[model samples]
Target: MAVALSTLVEEANRYLNCAAISDYCPNGLQVEGRPQVLRIVSGVTASQALLDAAVEVNADLILVHHGYFWKGEDPCITGMKQRRLKTLLKHDISLLAYHLPLDLHPDVGNNVQLAKQLDITVEGPLDPSNAKVVGLVGSLAEPVTARDFSRRVQEALGREPLLIEGSAMIRRVGWCTGGGQGYIDQAVLAGVDLYLSGEASEQTFHSARENDISFIAAGHHATERFGVQALGDYLARRFALEHLFIDCPNPI
Candidate 1:
């Protein structure tokens, strides 16, 4: 069944509370295509590959975590941006994107979703003072060695995580998925023995080793795939529309 494009956007805004969270890019309806959406495709990023997959699936709307028109980006569309925009325009497929809003949602947010998958008991935000905390600190079900913890992350996400040894035991863990390795320091201050993020920086390894906190660099695309998929599944069940998740895997 086809649902009005406006209705989908409205629900997304309400569900994500997009207005409350400040984002680099617009949170809803980045591109307009069809009046009604019969089939929707969701992905981690709205890259050329994901868009091409959406076209292959004959998607009317593409839901994503990352969208175009970010702050500090080139104002004019040139080579890559031009190609992506042209494909969406030529194919008449809508694009719906949510950035921080998707990451900060309590129930379906990336942080919470990852904690659930990793079997960590939620404690609270890594930084409580920050109104919109995108990262969370929690305790594992049982205390495990740093090696054991890394193995769990590898198994759960279906990817080998780059591990940095911190301590012998890891009971408490903090995480912010998708290029959030920068938050390892904050997670350290929060007293978590382990810090998990999608990407790792040179400084990240040093910080983890020096601060006595275990670090896990789980792929950015892998850590972030859940939120968009969860949102798509939710919208699908709520409105009785067809929803498909197109995985355009990225090692980074």
Candidate 2:
């Protein structure tokens, strides 16, 4: 029913292959807590709301896709950062986070999970030349209009995504889960009829139009909800520990 905190962290790090991926933030165990863990709380981000929810549930550890101490963040812990850290330290709840690793993992990665959710059969990486790109190229069983695909995305993510509709039937598709509009060009190069990402930039629309590819910008939070839940369920089954996923929804 219980596992050591260190043991859990080690297995998670190994399972996600965290060390091999370079990320903006640390991959595992951002904060240390009690030696033994009985219950785990997982969320998309380690925001104060999620921490409060975790505390309310008396979780021994908090697992998330996004955690503190990112690259280029101010070293000083003040204000919001201070409050979040205080809550974790006050409750002695370990913080386990994985950024790129969770997105890149073959089974539980965000892109793969999203493909499963959208009924897209994954083909390969979005860019064959780039190993660092976390997106994937996939295909629907049949071609559908851009609007229909948009509806599918809205239905699955529970949010209306911004669509830059092109005059193309969506069949071969490409997607990345979080803030991956930057990879649209890569998706284009891969010859996808539609490309989906969590957030879209100003230039993304132009790329979709000029390249004759449909583009969808689903909310970053909505798109990334699957991976952490999958990872949490996996750890729960693997270690026989109770796991709960708390969704502190973010519109963006």
Candidate 3:
């Protein structure tokens, strides 16, 4: 049996528990498509490559971490923006996106999934006040050297991670899966031995040295792929719809 696009989106919103807050873009059903959805495609970003892959698979719905209609973007649809939307609309493929909700979900979130893959048991959120915070505080099953942890991240994600080791061995760790170098301070204050994130800025090295916290920059796209894949699998099982996760290699 095929699932309705509206039904799948409603189920996702409830399962992710995303109805509480105001988001930059609409969380579900950004573009209308066929009434009955049989195949679903998931990806990190709704780029042209992803869209093309979804089209190739004849996906009725496309779910992504990054979607259209960001806060600071121009409302006028033209150029690349028009092209993306035009492709989805022309192909009758619905677009469903979950941003912060997907990032913070305890089970299927990027941080939690990354931690699980690394054999880290999540203790709690790094920031208690902000429920939307993507970083998580967790402890390793056993203490491991910072160098070993760095290599493990590289091996798990299939990308060499940039590591800035501190004096301490890593057991307690904090991680945010994508572009989350800013959360290092929170991790340091939380008394974690290491801070892991997808991307690092020029100042992250200085922050790591001064703050005495080990830092690791695993590839942004590599670290973030797990959560959406988990979510897609859950959705597929729940609704019995066909789901595929398409990975687009991103260096940064």
Note the clash tally of each candidate: 0, 0, 0
lDDT of 3 at 98: 86
- Sorted by lDDT, highest first, which candidate order results? 2, 1, 3
lDDT of 3: 0.90
Q: Rate the local accuracy (lDDT) of all candidates.
A: 0.90, 0.94, 0.90
Model 2 stretches with alpha carbons more than 4 Å out: none
> Compared with the true structure, what per-residue lDDT tens digits does model 3 show for residues 1-252?
798777888999998888975777778778888899999999999999999999999999999988888898899989999999999999999989888787888889888889889999999999888866668899988899999999899889988889999999998999898888988888888999999999999989999999888999997888889989999999999989899999999988
Write the residue-wise lDDT of candidate 2 on 87-143 in tens digits. 999999999999999999999999999999999999999988889999999989989
Which is superior by lDDT, 1 or 2? 2
Q: Per-residue lDDT of 21-114 in model 1, one digit per residue for the tens? A: 7878899999999899989999999999999999998999999998999999888989999999999999999999999998988877888888
Question: For model 3, where is the 10-residue window of minimal lDDT?
Answer: 20-29
> Which order, best to worst by TM-score?
2, 1, 3
Top-lDDT structure, candidate number: 2
Instruction: Please give the lDDT score at residue 132 for candidate 2.
Output: 92
**Candidate 1: segments with Cα more than 4 A from true spot:** none
Worst 10 residues of 2 by lDDT: 18-27
